[model samples]
Target: MLQIITEKFFPPGERYETLHRAILYTNYRVMRGEKIITPIGYLLPSTGLHSLATLTCEMLEKQEKYPDGPKLGVFVATTGDDLLNDFAAVISFFLNVTCTPDPDLTRRLLLAERPSLGIEAVPSRFIRRMFDKDVHARDGEAAALTAFIKQLIGLERETFVGAMRAIRQFVIGSHRLADDLNLAYTLFVTSIESLAQGFDGHVAEWSDYDPRKRKKIDGALKDASDEVAAGVRDAILSNEHVALARRFRDFAMAHVAPSFFRVEAAGAQGPISGPDLPIALQQAYSIRSSYVHLLRDVPRQLTISGFPEATEVDDRKTLSFAGLSRLSRHIIMQFIARGRIVEREAFDYRRELPGIVTVKLSPEYWVASTGGFDHKTAPVRLAAFLEQITAAVLQHQKDAKLTDLGPILTMVEHSVSGLRKPSQRLPMLTLYFLFHQFAGPEFSCKQWPALFEKHKADFDAPTVESFVAHLITGNRVEWTLEQLEELHKTYFKTRHTASVTKIGLLLEAALSLYVAEVNRLAGNNARARALVAFAVDSHPGHAALRTYEASLPAELAEINWTGILLPPRPSSEGPSADPVPAA
Candidate 1:
């Protein structure tokens, strides 16, 4: 624990913009909740949180920060900093444990201290800025809302903290992206998925296949080679969408609240009782899958957030986003309350490490914005290069005909070789997303006629822009210049869509770096300089490219490539933005 607490720091002249952290004790108290102790101190038993004022506040006589009115909840953290995340998490864990889903729950989500006019700064980096002030939840409208919470529950201190942390983030996300309904809904589901991953009895079922056939299939795989068996196993389990959907729905059903069907939703929204409940629940997960893999839209009712918000999709598969949001919170609450213990050693304390790389559940699994990174941290900046490339691959996986996936694997293999483990925030899936963000759906890219030759390989690598500008351009195929040029235009250029997204900009910059490396290796220093210069321009403030440019031979480093025009090469992979979720 960093014993020295400090208020949110702002640039010298922006002290007025500096928001102070104030812990106001609300009238609400935790019921059946016991005191929780951490290394530095213990949370007031009723609140399940400890408030430590910053040193700056102790020394200065600052103007009043928050309003004089009383706020919501047992624990309300009014911070203009990252610490609000903790407030959300603690409140979520507390509510979950206590089974007190107050109808005014949304009021309790006041984590950030934003100016009433809204956040003024144009974000220059990754950040988590505001808290949702949506109408407070009306848990009483749904009978099952708080039905599952048990009395006198005992959860391991570690399990309690971990659940709190994960929920805080996902809940924040649900509110943050509430406007982008699909992504917001997905985040809500992912929050539950994160909790489900390590759930007890979370058996690694190969697939939800017929048991009779499954037994034979298991036998068939008995003597198979490791790679062959593993591949087969993966193929068999590829329909995890169903398993996950059923897992969610079944989890809900297995613990059906005693009063779940006692009443109808307040609005004329379709019924979620009897068969409708499970169907809507399953459909919620189904809608989540559609948005995830195909970017599909949600049912109309689900898109609009409202009171008595649970909508029945009688004509289609559906659960209102609000309905799902409330459901997810309940599931999480029940999950944390039911989970009495998790092995103390099971916690990934690495998350608490002081390293610049702070691993979080992907907002892309309930991931959130990471903070505290700066130019001094080389790996975080360098990791962005690969991170963006992974984003590109995932974005184009379906349309880019980018079947030459092996090249990026080699690129990642080469790039990550000397990287420290801490710097490797890259998720395990970077076939660009192998670093993070990629969910390993079978992506589509144009395959050369002879490429089915790779069917037996580990994965169908969506190779670098179909090998036209692949760094190892000639490694596998003998492409005549004409074929290379034609393929490059038809696939990489024509099929590519323009993107103005932040991720798109970074992907464009990364591809420029990708080409720069290729050109440099090819001894085309001038072109390499042009590419690097373009990359630097596209993604300003990148440390890796800047360092590489600074280290250039003194004479060449002095040469300006900015004004010089270079012929466009047929092999150049240009910028195109495809929406890639966070890695």
Candidate 2:
């Protein structure tokens, strides 16, 4: 019967496959309750095919056994609707034909004749009354046993309600169940969205003669309803109902009400026009807000030193903006865990942390009138202060003095890359500046590269934003783009032709010689003129040769007759002795 029903609805196989996965996922949710805000992945829906196959197969076997008997036309007259109403009926009828003589429970159920004899009746009844304080249960073990036994005793109206209530409470209190609810809700909603995309109001109708197949699907949907109701009940019981209500009110006031204009602007594409979109979005927002304010604890403490007082607006926006962003992240995580949202190993929002990013979470940006401490000045001054503090710390770390300057220079070199010419400090750049400022520019220039290289492997790749975190926490290196570039160069030499290398080496030697000659000039004014002229030269190679040639007096310039390095085998063997210049 079960196989028959399952196959009827799951005809294409894909539906069954998707639904099987979904059922497994929902079972997990029924197990996890309120912590539903946790992440969950996607789930597929069920098809009613297999259930019908089981029913048909059972009837065929039963008819073969009773061929000469009164049961010949009994099952043939039974419709899918009748089979659905009495789920246990098919199993009992089969047992009568196929089993050894008769099974005890099968005989009992077949003879009972009322809904009380329904398969789930007894067990539901027992569980309902067992957990009550007034109920005389000998021990926890006894209570559990009694609950299971009584649950099977048949569902009188009171017992059914009692059983549901107990199950609901149990699910609510179970952390696992809470997690499932959040997961399932997110996954279900996402699946529904996907399903809606293909809906377009087109559906295939089954033949009237195939009514049996319809019954199986309806039965599956009914079972799904039971699961959903159980999950909802558990979810409701897990959290403070009043708090949820308060959250709804707050979300409406802060987001929905204020953002109604945006939705109107969106027109047909908006949530207002969406099917059940408002409720889903609002519920998501409410749950997230509640989790943030009540669980994750956003709107962190703000300590202001030397300020007169913090205004009410400060606290209000704290709860609104920062709080909202945090809640959004939490909700996203919940959906991901539930299989509703796709998970990425890393998330980059770009702007995060006030000290690190110039933009705070507030809607406001630059403030013009706060004297020395407006919004613009605040980040700048804070950066400068951080720089000084880092410099001071490094100064005290006298042990680093013995380290090679190569690594230190590398840090300073890297720090320069982050410099924003206008304000001069990028958020991340400030850290490098602070490192140089505190460790003393010299230490930053010398030790950072070694420190960075030493700890490179320890970096976390899951969320690469922690690069800043690693540096701050390790306190091993001061960083700057200039130093980083130099380090990179040191580690990776460019591979060019040998000719290029030779030219580079020769040019460096020549430039060094020029600097030396200028330093030996007679007067400061003369030295300044020579240096300035060299600096202003448009052609470096030309100016360098010119500078070399003009650096000495005319008498020195004229002595080119062959003696230097034996002047390449002069054919004349010229007796040119100019005190032969040293090689």
Candidate 3:
């Protein structure tokens, strides 16, 4: 029966004749109820049943001469009954299934054929033993083939697979099944748009339009009266088309086709690039809109005479649709490629610290330091540091005796107000602490006049001798008229020169000596001594402070200070300020 069927239905060729004999031999087993097993390689077009049969016949013709050689039974016994049944099923499927090849089936056949002559024929003994096994295996193979086909076509491998499938279907002419170019175009555009949305999610800025609109609405509500805000929100919601148009324009203008509007040349006669993508997309969208809305005019023109007219309007519309499809594919693929590059190049945004922490002394520390008047507007790092420092300071302040901190705090606040840079504030505050340690907590502006007054008699000579004596004595007295006038005009006034006379030397020496002792107690002895040395070497009066240093009380000179060491204040040429006694 197989021989007759092959002779009648199969094409008359060397290929068909060999395949015919293999089918006959396989069929004979089924008739005899003998099991037959088939190798997957026997399904290959070049090396399948035809090749197996040709090899088997060649071996058999020589068996008469050498009877002990390979036997035909070896090949026949393994070409199992299951293979026959599968072959039958395949045939029935081809006959019953639609005339058009199933994309899935075609894909499977291609993969099954891919192994470059590596797959081998089954051995008879093993084939007999696994006849039923091969039956189940065949079913599994079918499923695997379907999977392999999907893989081969590169579908279901990414987020944009559905879009790709639509494109693939159109390219392969499967779109003809529906014979609806309009619907095909719609699906292509829809898929492309879906891909664009996927691209948007992976990118920055492009993904923000909708959220930004919502944010705008949220912000408006904060300023509007309840009823007015509600009305405004309703108005915005009602005008979604306007918002969508604006968003589409922004995206199309920015990324997909930025050069869509550029002139082709540089001159007055240079042609303006026309039929712009944005405009084309607008028209494409209008067509889609017309289709969706079932506009009376759209259906009449689109369906007339079973085809669109060859008019200029129709040609332009068709061209626009084609352009949009091609553009979408280009844009999606470009973004996907861009997204990959971004993924490869992305880096962590965290920054390393500079290893120096500035302590904030008050609740408004960051504001005062940064000059950011409003706390909400402070720099992120500054604000964070402020919080950390404020917490630490408050915690430390809880344990420490904060006596006479009021005057010192006032000085710090006043100095901070005068400072320009945030970095300068911390060092200025450190200077305040050095001054507090030098003059004691009782220090304030009230003591200024008294100290100057005590030097009044010395200033009679208008000489340096009187100033050194006053500092060495540490006198407490109100400022006399002559002393106050001389001190204010000479030392405190703007554009005043450093007092180089004996009085100036004595004041500078005393200030530098006190600064050294304060810094030494704070554990920065080296820096403190360096500062004193620098002061003494730079100015003549500063040397007098070292000379008077030994005359200070032992307790004042030797008190043990235990705390974090503060960095030295930056150098300045003028004399450090005199201590102001607390009011």
Give the winner by TM-score: 1
Per-candidate local distance difference test: 0.41, 0.28, 0.33
Ranking by TM-score: 1, 3, 2
Top candidate when judged by lDDT against the true structure: 1
TM-score of each: 0.38, 0.16, 0.24
Q: Any runs in candidate 3 off by more than 4 Å, and if so which? A: 1-178, 201-242, 245-275, 295-321, 341-583
Model 1 has an lDDT value of: 0.41
Q: Kindly list the per-residue Cα lDDT of model 3 for residues 1-583, writing each as its tens digit.
A: 1112112222334221123222311111111222223312122211223211101111010001123444563211222333233333322221111111233332232223332131221111111111111112233443443332223223222432333433343232212212344554455455445444443433223223477677866775897788897677666655543334334434444455443224312221212234444554555555655655673222223232221111134444332222343344444433333331111111121111122255645333232333332212222322332232322222232222222324334544545546554333433333233334334434644434343344334334322223333333443324443553354234323223322221233244343444455556667656565645544553544333434333444334442111111123335522223222222
Per-residue lDDT tens digits for candidate 1, residues 516-555, read: 5545655667776776677667667656556666677733
Question: Over the stretch 1-583, how does candidate 2's per-residue lDDT look in tens digits?
Answer: 2223222212232211111111210111112111111011121222323211111111110111233444543222223332222222211111111111113332232222332321222211112221111222122432332333233222332222233332222222221111232332233222222222222232223222135644665555565677784564454344422333333333333323323334322421112222333343454444445544565321223111111111123322222221222222222222222221211122221121112345332111211112343223334433333332222222222221221223223433455444434223232233333344334343444444554454343332211112223332343233343343343233224313221111122222222233323344423344434533443342354443455445655232222211110113435532211111111
Model 2: per-residue Cα lDDT at residue 534: 40
Write down the worst ten-residue block by lDDT for model 1. Answer: 52-61
In TM-score terms, candidate 2 sits at 0.16
